[model samples]
Target: MKKILEIIRYEYVTQVRRKGFWIGIFSIPIMIILSSGISVLAMFIGTDRTPVGYVDHSGVLASPVLPEPDGLFGESMEFIAYTDPAVARQALLDGAIQGYFVIAENYQQSGMVEYFTPDLSYDMVIGDFEDLMRHNLLQAYPETVRTRFEQGSNITVRALESTQQLNLDQWWNLVLPLVIAFLLFILIQVGGSYILQAMVTEKENRMMEILITAVTPTELMVGKTIGNLGVALTMLLVWGLCGGAVLLFLPAYALTQVSINWGVQVIAIVLFLETLIMMACLMLMAGVMATDAREAGQLTWFFGLVMSLPFIVITSVIFDPDGPMSTIMSLFPFTAFFVMPVRMTFTQVPGWQVALSIVLLAGMIALAVWLATRAMKQGMLSFSRKIKYSDLLKQRRAA
Candidate 1:
């Protein structure tokens, strides 16, 4: 136990001291800060809001009443009435306006209006002008009709015979599950890579032979796994702290809008931790079989793709959380990490199913650790060559 602790301390200290590790740790927060700063700067340094011209050939809007300029929203529209189309074209050429609108002579009857702009891709500008025209047209209607149009219609949605009542439209609830799943995926992949790299580096340096003289294969494997796990957890802790800070500083209205279930969150965290452990063990086995970092990376990426297959069908899991497909995915050890959390988030899963998934995942983790330990023992002396899966099993039987 003391030797294991020593190994953990050595691994942690050595990794933490590396410039790459520290750079990775702080990169995310730095990016967030820089993004926020750019946004704030852009708010102060506003974009140019060129005036738009209009030509009323229909004679309907001979003397139109435009809204007063409100600096809070943006620059007010400057309308220039032109009777001749040739004069309007010359004004546009002179750069007197950003765009021009031409109302047809039969505009009131045909409801046809033409707009000319150098850039047609300015959707926001076009949309704003359309909205302004619509509002003005509505104002010319009867008072009752104008009031009804302005007030708009109300819609109230109610769910009947529902097992779970969650607002899927809410930003946090919609995003949180995916965020958690993605984070778990990153943690497993990155932590596993660390284990693989460490093992390969030690082997290349002939440090494994020296370590073998001091500790058993099981201890070394367990120590390295636990050490890397600690590193991953530390990263999670730092990110959690940053997230907590954001939550603390967030507006009260934003907090009220997002409804979080603590019970579900706790369960998800446990499942994520378990998934990481299993991935770490599997990566250890891959590292044992790999002769170099290049081979280790290929093997790790292959496992990553297999593990990420659940994400491909995430849309199905979200829409039909309790369907047969979701059930099978939740029960399967490879996919359960992503599927189960999504199931728990959007719907109410049965207790038995959750238990079964947990048991299956736990069993897989144990089996993975056992296989990894055996592979490490056998492959320690067999360096610069790949370890066959069949040989490992056969050797276990022979032992």
Candidate 2:
């Protein structure tokens, strides 16, 4: 146990110290931040915040009230009523306003308003102007009637026989599951690659012989797998910190306060850790079997493709969460990690399905560990040749 702990500490320190690891950790988040920043800057540059002049021939804007802002950031807009279309056009030409709306005399009956904008900057403010007109049109109505007309109707779907409910306001509920699954996929792939690296690098360089003198095959495998997983966890931690900071202090937009499903998150986390271990073992076996890292990568890529088949049918999972296809994928070992959480998020999945999936995954992991242990020493000791699956089983039986 002490030796395994030593191996874990050594492996964690070595991998985290690598420049590539740090680069991979920081590069993606930085790119996302920069991209989002550039997009927001471009939006601001494209906007024309100058006063917007209007020719109110219908007299609807005779008393124009300033509309409330509706965007990621506070808005600065003005709508000035004009007695003449010529004056409004001149205001646009003089750069006093980026756009002008000519309300026809029959606007109250025909609901027709002519828009003349020099640029696309008025695309966002058009809705606000319509709201202002609505507000003035409803001037004689009660406050409740005016508010309802302006706000529109929101439809919430609730099952007649059950407590199931869905609405546009709960969009984050649908997204949370996919995010959790993708995070699992990323951690498993990244951590598995490092596990392959740890084993393959040591074997090809003949360092495992030195390792073997002090540690057993099982110890080496478990320690290295866990250590690299720790490296991946460190990456997740850093990224989480960066994300938390952005959510708290982002200059462009404010994220709404959300109620997260911590229960589902905890389940996804356990599955992620177990799935990582299983994948790490398999990757270690492939690494020891291959002659070089490139060949190992090819083999792992094929394995990755097989595991990634679930993402192809993700649309089915999302739209029909309680359907048979989603349930089948939830139980399949290769697809369960990505599909199950998403299914759970979309609906109330039966407890039996979750338990069965976990049990089946445990069985798969045990089998993988057994095969990997049989191959580890034999493959590591003979770097000149590949360890055929047949040869491994036969050799293990013979021993």
User: Which residue segments of model 1 deviate by more than 4 Å?
Assistant: 29-48, 55-88, 103-112, 133-163, 319-327, 396-399
What tens-digit string does per-residue lDDT give for candidate 1 at 1-399?
888888888777777788887787678667767897888667546534677777887766676755434344556656677777778888888998777889888987997888887776653455546555655777678877865675555433233544455764465776787877777777777777778877887877778889989987777888888998888887788878887898999999988887776666776777778888998898888788777888777666767887888888999998898899999998888788788888887777888988888889899999999889888877777677878778789988899
| Alpha-carbon deviation at 272 in model 1, angstroms | 0.8
Give me the runs in candidate 2 sitting further than 4 Å from their true place. Answer: 118-122, 152-167, 239-256, 306-315, 382-399
The candidate 2 region of ten consecutive residues with least summed lDDT is 250-259
- Clashing pairs for model 1 are none
TM-score: model 1 vs. ground truth: 0.80
What is the overall TM-score of model 2 with all chains considered together? 0.83
For candidate 2, the lDDT comes to 0.80
Candidate 1: how large is its RMSD? Answer: 4.3
